[model samples]
Target: MPEPELRTDRLLLRRWRESDLEPWAAMNADPEVREHLGEPLTREQSDAVAALMRAEFEERGFGWWALEVRATGEFIGRAGLDEVDAGMPFAGVDVGWRLTRSAWGHGYATEAALSCLAFGFEVLGLPEIIATTTVGNVRSQAVMRRIGMTRDPADDFEDPSVPEGPLRRCVLYRIRRDAPPAARRAAGS
Candidate 1:
């Protein structure tokens, strides 16, 4: 089954299109946007990630859906669930997002992420979902909290994919089916 389109008051979360490639590459190339994610990617590397996302959607019916501003139809970035990377200690789906610099401070990540969580728990019947971010990525951590995830300091781990450094130390946050009522409401459940 194909992933169904998801919408919020101001955004549309849907599959990637060939037309999305250029902006996606530009976003990946921005050093500010890539700060916690590692070095800015070359266009080829960006394209490869997009290709992998498409393949994930094809194989699993969902991946990181390209995010768009509903009113202007602008491609902002992507937000959705993905399988936790193999090196992580956790086991289950993870929620994540990346947006263009212009799209920051707009609460779009929270809105879209709430929708993804709702789908993961309510639609897919997932028991839980987790999110991990570089310890320095406070903004993303705030978003996770806004959507009802709670972090356990004991569960923090160093990301093996990242070199031993400030960025390698990561924090894990999780939300389960029994999350708070406010959180469920945030997810539109």
Candidate 2:
């Protein structure tokens, strides 16, 4: 079967396009947008990543999808499920998302992520899905909770790859397939 595209009420999670490279590069170049993600990325780096994301889905049937506003076809960013990096201690599929500053505070991340979880569990037949981010990323943590993923302090750890800094201290959150849908979208995005 082909790599599948996912949709939320307002977002379309699909493969990347050449047209997205420019906006993707611009979004990555924004310091505010890259604040929690370390440093900004160059156009070439952005393009390379988009290429890799596209290739991964084609190769594995599941990978990052370029997130777009269904009404406008705007390439806001990316959201999907992928295996945790090899450097991490735990092993399993993980859900993640990155959106342009304009897209933040719009609940697009939570919508797309919830869609990803449904896909991981219902379609991919995954037993569980996890999400991790630096402890400082309360926005993302809120989204995780809003989507019903719970965090255990014990699951938090220092990222082996990141240098000694805030980004190094990461926290993990997870939701099992059998867990009840505990969706609780708090106010204020």
- Give one digit per residue, the lDDT tens place, for model 2 in 1-189: 477898778999987888989999999999988877888999999888888888888988998998999999999999999988897889899999999999999999988998888888888888888999999999999999888889999999998988888889999998888775343222111
Model 2, 136: alpha-carbon shift in Å? 0.3
TM-score of each: 0.97, 0.94
Report how far residue 150 has shifted in candidate 2, in Å: 0.3
Model 1 TM-score on a 0 to 1 scale: 0.97
Give every collision pair in model 1: none
Best by lDDT: 1
